[model samples]
Target: MLADGLSLAKMNCFSRKLRRTAPELGSSKNELVPSKLPRINGWSWPLHGFQVVGWLVYIYLAIVSFGIYIPLLPPPWNHVVHALMGIIFILHFIAHIAALTIDPAEAGVRAKQSYSSPVPLFDRSKQSHVIQDLHCYLCNIRVGPKVKHCAACNKCVDGFDHHCKWLNTCVGGRNYWCFFVALTSATLGVLLLAIVILFIFIQHYLDPNCLRTAPQYAGIQGNTTWLVFLPLAPVKTSSAGLLIVAFGTLMLSITCLMMFAHLMAFHFYLFYKGISTYDHIKMRRSKESNIEAGKPPDVKTNNKAPKFLQT
Candidate 1:
């Protein structure tokens, strides 16, 4: 009888232990659920690699055109090459600005905050749809649809893409067009300069005297004249001049071709989709459409969206 009593006591103890542990197991399962989705990390790898390479190539070309080659060229053509290089350089600057301005799509929130109270910290419910109307308690700001706080910029930008390290700024809605245009112009300018340089090289190679002549200076107090245009009239057969032209031309041609190809591809994709680099990265797939017919609908508020957002 004692053994029977002891067995009953052990069973009861086992049941109590299971009951006590059940809540803990349930809590652990809940912890696995993520509060929000991850945002865009940065530029796509291919675009990043391409931009780095292009920048390096353009910088190298700029050095050669402005610092080394142009100063040594003869009158007329020297001035022409210098003018071309200046254009290319200016375009590069524009490209830098464009890269700095963050696109709307690339921008994203670092963290999200939720409040249960009907009173919003910032009145956004009247401006946005229920899903998009959000109040960030940390910032004490109201964010609209597709709006995100950028930690890098320390502010919210609509449709923000990732912060561009190259530009040292965020690429967003306001500056994306300029950035793209700058890139296009820079690429084109580089190509033109490359062609001109290559032509000079080939002409010199065929006729060494084509690039050689009296080195003319164009400065007031010093020998600091803008490199004049290359004297295109004389077609000499100087071996040394031909060699210099050949090497310079080859380098410029290669760099221009590569830049052209890359920009062409970038623009083609941008135009095909009618979206900016920022937008392509952040917009999510339609999750609402995936909901089953019988599932309870998401609670929506009759909120007025921000002016920047699509209706």
Candidate 2:
């Protein structure tokens, strides 16, 4: 009877130990599996600051262009100019939204993984490269030849372009078209605004009466210059107000135009070469590294002609 009782006690003790260790083992397993997807959006202070500054500049330019400059123009030209600007603005805004929101993650990562089933943890100790045999160690999946891991986004992007700090997103296969559209529209809009402002500046000096031909200015005297804040409220002022605003708009527009134009040109060059921004950057870096190593630059391979040219 004592033996039976002692055996029962030992069994109960063993069961208790098993229960404790089972929970520990389960917890460890859970720790190994990631519970959430890697962050794809760039949520940083610089992104927020860029967004704020961009909006402020856009608003200021819009208000001045639509409220003051456009009104100063005569007749049908004013209406036509307003419609054109509105279209360009809409295109730019829509393209920006699309580019910013689209998921540029690699096909396998997007299709196979989610918050509930996150990518498996990569064991770098056993591997030399993050990518081997077209399989990504970090993403733990097979990726395309052009797939690249964006450190900022913490995911692999298919046809990986460059991460745009302004948009706060990765530009890849999915969003590259939208990004290009946004770039093009923004460039056009700023260039148009600059040209209109320049025209207004010339009219302000040479033919001031031509600018005051709007219905609102019909009763106002020629010498009584006015600064129109809103359509309904035209504040009487000297030439200084109009000139100051015109000069400021011109300066901003010129600066933005220069930047956008350069970016557009660079992208066009990449497109003509049938390569992405990432590829161009990588090739350039390889050339520099070779130069540093005192090796002859492999121009034929590094800067190969496009397929069309080769054909």
Candidate 3:
């Protein structure tokens, strides 16, 4: 009936550790108390760097598009607009990285032993709601309700959400809000870039003179603009620059915007239903004992999340 090897304070925090470690139930349970584990490694950092570098290049080009490519354009498509877009992109970009790297507040893994459930005051004859909590063999601890054991991290995370390969970490109770905000900001930043690029293309077709990149071929500027690299018309340096902006900034911006939009919408529904993307994708039955059931501690029946998780 005792929590065995751990102290009172340590027992109090044991449930939290399940929400933080790798989820593998097969890991060695030697450590009695949870320790901070490394999130990024040499093998994973390269892929993470790829994501960082790709976004950096895209953001840089979106910012410079205003100053170099189409300065002669009219209001809304001018330096002011470009500067605004750049600022937005930078702000959201920073938010995304910050959320990605921040620890999702891992739980403390404390080994637990055979324990008897306490009786409630009003129902001394009958026990209050029991969540049917499971034992994490790998962590060598009994897991609490809604705490999902990650086999990959070989640790348990409370309010376990999806594993974001981009961040190279699991998104759970601690970082869900930040993850949502990052997706939102990144989407908007890229969308603004797309809008700006689209406007430039529209202006080019309507009045080529308005486009700085419009070809100056024999007093009759052809259909080539920043959006088009080479039409039936001769190629100019400005037009070539426009081509880069077209495929590079515009396409990438729209693609990123669409992806984040879908992600935000999906997560919004998850928030409304009070579930996580992990639950939706895997749809594991949490009622069983084994990890294959993907059993998370069932908090709704009895236990409640902590103050920080509620936030």
Candidate 4:
């Protein structure tokens, strides 16, 4: 009984500290949850399955890079590019998984006051029934400013950004940096994979014997891709090289790699503007409001340039 009481006391003290220290999110309460805030959600079994697929793809990349491609190439292709790419990209992937588990901010909460309960006269605890400053209607806790209630997680997060279906978590506050790093590294890494695959596949054809046949058919060295893009001709189809090329490059090109590219570009624009995606939407709404009110919309085109040159 005594041990449980002590544990409860400690928890209460920690909760008090959080409430006392947490800052306000915004000037107004209603403005807390902006639209399209981080699609980032928390961990779940479904996300675990999603990330597993990414890992499988990465492992396949490694097999294609080291196990299949390098052996076919000359001494020049045996450099440390593959190793470096794996290290950097793997580190970022790990960072993303780690970031997903972290809470952007912790809100403070305490039990509601009960007037019928008598206070202990002998014990001089610092205070009684101290509630948090900002209360979350959803979470039933006091959250700091920038903290918004995540409907998916059913918790009020500090600096609640967005719920990411990929990570299955809300990417908020300091966690966003790691998430961005993950995106950048993953995108670049996939791009590197595409480049490497193209180089190796093209290099294979550079072998003079590749196209020149034994007088049965016309020799074709240059890309006959213009003839038709689909059902890639069985040129060297017997070689494992073709299979690896198709699997590692083509599969990723259509899926993870391409999606990462476009997603990175979108986030880059958001970061350059120094605003969250939600904030961009808010700006658009404000501009529309101005238009509706018959006010001349501020006509500054959001050109991507240095602040000094922008002026």
Candidate 5:
């Protein structure tokens, strides 16, 4: 009886050990083995923060592209601007779709360093493994050759550049050309129209009817004329000039911000050991107590030479 009890106890211990080590698989192809894998749930809030900021840009783009239409402009220019605006909207929609379709967790792209394996390698035999390997852990989505994931869109995007929330689309390889075309056309069109309006305002400014008015310079100098009124001339102050300046400023600011972000991100990714912004932030937090107590990072304790490198 004692021997029998001993065997049963050993079996129970082995079963518990198996339960502790076994990696759980999910039902769907896209579902991840949550128990064994790392996760980026903390990143969702920051991503949503960026999305909220993007919505503001979208509203501005929408108002300028669709709501404000001028009848005085030539048919060709008007049609061109309208067409570009429509394209921007479509691109934005596609970006959102891409984000939803590509799940970062399933793709093996976790925001937190602890959630992902240090190497992020796979055998390439399993479909899920293949997908995750293609994605790489640094970013969130699996894309094809020559394609990269857009952080802003939170998905694996094709030929990806930065996401333009204003257009609501991922600037991927497939649509980069279109995005540039729309941007260039819209900028030129706004400048041209602003110039025309300034010219018209100048012409009216010089009219003799201005001098005979009861409030001398009343119509010419009213709040609308001075503050909001736009002249319709290329050379002088008009609605056209105002619009061109405003749009030009907007374009410049957004472009500069995007460029700065890209440069910073690229610099870190290339120079560092494939570490990301998320990793840096977490590392900092993890070491905060140690740093305050005058200790070094945990890495220092485990700084051993690899066998291959030693050889």
Candidate 6:
């Protein structure tokens, strides 16, 4: 009877212990499994703060230049300038949209992993590179020679160029053309706007009448110079307003030109060299690493047309 009672007590204790450990065991099991890929809300502007800022800046500049400055010019010239700037802005907007929405992931990765699936965790300890033998560790799939895993996008991009923070996406094989168009349009637009602003500034001093040619400024009499913020309301021109607008336009033009011009020139150089931005960066890093390791860098010579320009 005592043995039976003791055995019952032991079984009850074991059941209680199993109940207590069950959740822990299950949690440990869960830990062993790979976690799902983070949901990348590409359409969410807030997710890409820089992208939002870029859009806002573009809108502000467009409004100030097209709405305010352009209208200050004479009839035909103002209309012509407005039309040209409008076309460039439209091209830029369309290209920007295309670059942002296109998926640049490797074909195999895109085919194998659905949006809902858990991407396999890459084991860096077991591999030297994210891709070895054309196989991606994280994606657990075969990829093309130019495929590279973008840490920012957390996906293997085919023909990876570079991740553009402005577009909040990777620029790769699919969207490279669109990105180039956007860059070109933006650069051109800013340059034209700067020229017009400079012309307007010179005209403001040399022949203020040319600037006030717009129909809205007809009511204001001589010596009481006025500047229009919005079309309907014209306020007497103040030194403060003139300085603010002039300085603001000048700063925006200079900053944007410096950035966009440099970027455009760099991309042109990359094309001339028959390399993508990723390749250039990787080569630079490799060279640096080799120098650090006290190893002489390999030298090779090739006299061939750039891949981009090849027939």
Clash count for each candidate, listed in order shown: 43, 0, 28, 22, 27, 0
Q: lDDT-based ranking, best first?
A: 2, 6, 4, 3, 1, 5
TM-score for model 1?
A: 0.49
lDDT of 1 by residue, 1-311 (tens): 99999999999999998877543422321111212322232342324654577577667766556654564455687788678778767866766644543333322232432212222222232322212245433233566655554544434556554465655455666665666676666666667666656666566446534444444322223221223223333233334554465476567666666866786696578679886554543232122322433433352232332233322
lDDT tens readout by residue for model 4, 20-135: 66435433323233222222234543455666676677777666555544333343444566466768667876887777766564435213322223222211122111123565
Please list the residue runs of candidate 5 whose C-alpha ends up more than 4 Å from where it truly belongs after superposition: 1-143, 150-154, 208-311
Candidate 5 residue lDDT tens string, 73-176: 33465466557656646664454444433333322333333433432223222223223335443333454543443333333444444445444445544554
Query: Candidate 5, after superposition: displacement of residue 50 in Å?
Result: 8.3
lDDT of 6 by residue, 245-293 (tens): 8679878988999999999999999999999987787666666556776
Better-scoring candidate (TM-score), 2 or 4: 2
Q: Rate the local accuracy (lDDT) of all candidates.
A: 0.50, 0.75, 0.54, 0.54, 0.43, 0.73
Instruction: State every prediction's TM-score relative to the real structure.
Output: 0.49, 0.77, 0.57, 0.58, 0.36, 0.78
* Candidate 3: residue 296 lDDT (0-100): 55
lDDT of 2 by residue, 1-311 (tens): 99999999999999998876543432332224332346555443346667667768878888888878887777788889989999998999889888877889888888876734445443223322456567776677888788876655667888888888777878999999999998999999999899888988888778888787766676777644765754677776677878888898899999999999999999999979998987787677767666877887674444532322110
Residues 123-234 of candidate 3 have per-residue lDDT tens digits of: 1122121122465544445566666655344355667887776666667787767767767767776676677677767766677665543343336445543332222333
**TM-score, cand. 6 vs. native:** 0.78
Cα lDDT for residue 86, candidate 4: 62
RMSD of each: 12.4, 7.6, 13.8, 14.7, 12.5, 7.7
- Winner by TM-score between candidate 5 and candidate 3: 3
Residue 171 of model 5: what lDDT?
A: 51
Q: Whose lDDT is greatest here?
A: 2
Better of 1 and 5 by TM-score: 1
Residue 291's lDDT in candidate 2? 80
